[model samples]
Target: MSDAIVVIPTYNEIENIEAIIDAVFAQEKAFHVLVVDDNSPDGTHQKVIELQEKYPERLFLEVREAKTGLGTAYIHGFRWVLARDYEYIFEMDADFSHNPEDLVRLLAACQEDGFDVAIGSRYVKGVNVVNWPMNRVLMSYFASKYVRFITGIPIHDTTAGFICYRRKVLETIGLETIRFVGYAFQIELKFKAWKLGFKIKEVSVIFTDRTKGKSKMDSSIFSEAVFGIIKMKIRSMFTKTKPHA
Candidate 1:
């Protein structure tokens, strides 16, 4: 079996699933993919099943019952990957916003550069996002700034969904304790890893707005993140973090 796996959580992503799988497989390095689908009525799981026949060994699919939050989908995927022996694990979006080609760079950051977490950062190289509204651009940019000021992680894109993690980092972190299920989940994971003294490095990458399907962003997700960080920081203060080996 391959030592690296990319876990992409999906919900009604038919327009992009097949293409995303192909893009990842087209990479120079051999990496496996696991699509954790949350019961996409648009036959997304059926598409994955079809691909599995072609790339039987490299592709996988897990179909869930209902629409759960993004964080829960990833947490479920994390547990599935952890049960196996993958050394390098990744979190990517089904939408082409995150370039599949850059997965190699993320892997290198951890496999060669000694970083435990490698983020596919949009702001690491001065706001490299494309085709987003000016208002959204400002909100996302300032959101990272607010997160940095509050959490003090030194990361340029704190809510970035595209990331790669060494297996050991997940093993050290108590996965069951992860709380927030929105974008805040991203911050919580990074913050917990940082608080435990893990090395996280941001790899510069371009984030394009998805050209197909609808975006899942909503006001509630933004609100949860705005308030959740404070709770997470407070919990960290009261809780004793385990030492990294």
Candidate 2:
């Protein structure tokens, strides 16, 4: 078995599911993939089942009963991987927004460079997003900036979903307590990791908007992120703990 596993959370991603799976498996590093698919009406989980025959032990699937928030889906995947022997656990998109080739770079940050968490950052070097309208881009770019300003987390891409976490980081962070389910979920994880003194590294990457399938971003997700940061910061102050790493 490979030491690394990429956990891809999916919902109604039939258009991109098969191709994304192939791109990830084609990588130079042997990375196992566990797809945590919320029961999609589009038969996305069925496609994964078919591909499983071809990939055998490398590709795995867990179908939840209904579509829930992205954070919970990832939490489920994290628990599943933690139960096994994998050392490197990743969070990636079913869409091509997150480059499959960059998986090697993220793995290097944790495995070779000894960082606890590696984020595939869009704003580290500059805003490296493609195919998105100017307004949406600004909202995302500024959102990260706002998060950095408020949370005192030095990360440039605090909301980036493309990430690699060394297994112990997750084990230490107390996954059961993770709040926010939308974009804020991304911010909350990074904040907690930083507060716990985990070393996080951002690997610059180009984030391309998906060509297929509908985008999941809505006003509620954005609003949650905007308001959630303050609440998170307030909550962190009262709680003090020793670093597990």
Candidate 3:
């Protein structure tokens, strides 16, 4: 098994699952994948199973009965990876928005460079997103700024789903206490890591909107992130912060 495992959360992502898995495996670096499928009726899980036959050791799957929140899926994957011997655990999307090629750079940021968490950031290099409306681009950009102002975390892309974390960092953070399941969940995890004195590095990447699959973004997820940041910030005041691992 590889030292790294990439966890991808999927819903109705049948159109993108196969290609994404292939793209990840095609990378020069050795990285295993775990697909946390929420019982996609579109047969997303079956596609993963088929791929697993070819990459028996590199590819794995976890199917759930019903659709749960994205945060829970990742939390489950994190716990599973921790139980094993993976040195680096990643969070990625089943949709092809996040570039698979950038996984190398993310890994380098931690393995070669000295960073505890590496974020595949879209905004660190001046809005590296394509095929998105101006409104959405602004919302996402400003959202990160808002999160930064509220939490005092110096991350550029606060809601970036593509991230690589060293095993020790995840083990240090109390994963069970993670609350929000929407986009805010991303921010919360990063905030807790930063609060605990983990060094986070942002690797510039281009985020292209997925062409084949439907988007999961909605007003509710945005609202959760907007309000959740305040709660997360306030809670951090009372709670004792964990030091760097």
Q: What is the TM-score of each candidate against the true structure?
A: 0.98, 0.99, 0.98
Residue 234 alpha-carbon offset, candidate 3, angstroms: 0.5
lDDT of 3 by residue, 1-245 (tens): 79999999999999999999999999999899999999999999999999899998899899988877999999988988899999989999988899999999999999999899999999999999999999999999999999999989999999999999999988888798899987789999999999999999999999999899899899999999999899989999999875974
How many residue pairs clash in each candidate at the backbone level? 0, 0, 0
Among the numbered candidates, top lDDT falls to: 2
lDDT against the true structure, each candidate: 0.93, 0.95, 0.93
> lDDT (0-100) at residue 160 of candidate 3?
97
Model 2 pairs whose backbones collide: none
Considering only N, C-alpha and C atoms within 3 Å, which residue pairs clash in candidate 1? Answer: none
Per-residue lDDT tens digits for candidate 2, residues 1-245, read 89999999999999999999999999999999999999999999999999999999999999999877999999999999999999999999999999999999999999999999999999999899999999999999999999999889999999999999999999999998899887799999999899889999999999999999999888999899989899999999898868874
Candidate 1 accuracy as lDDT: 0.93
What is the Cα-based TM-score of model 3? Answer: 0.98
- What's the lDDT for candidate 3? 0.93
Model 2, residue 52: displacement in angstroms?
A: 0.5
Clashing pairs in 3: none
Name the regions of candidate 1 deviating beyond 4 angstroms: none
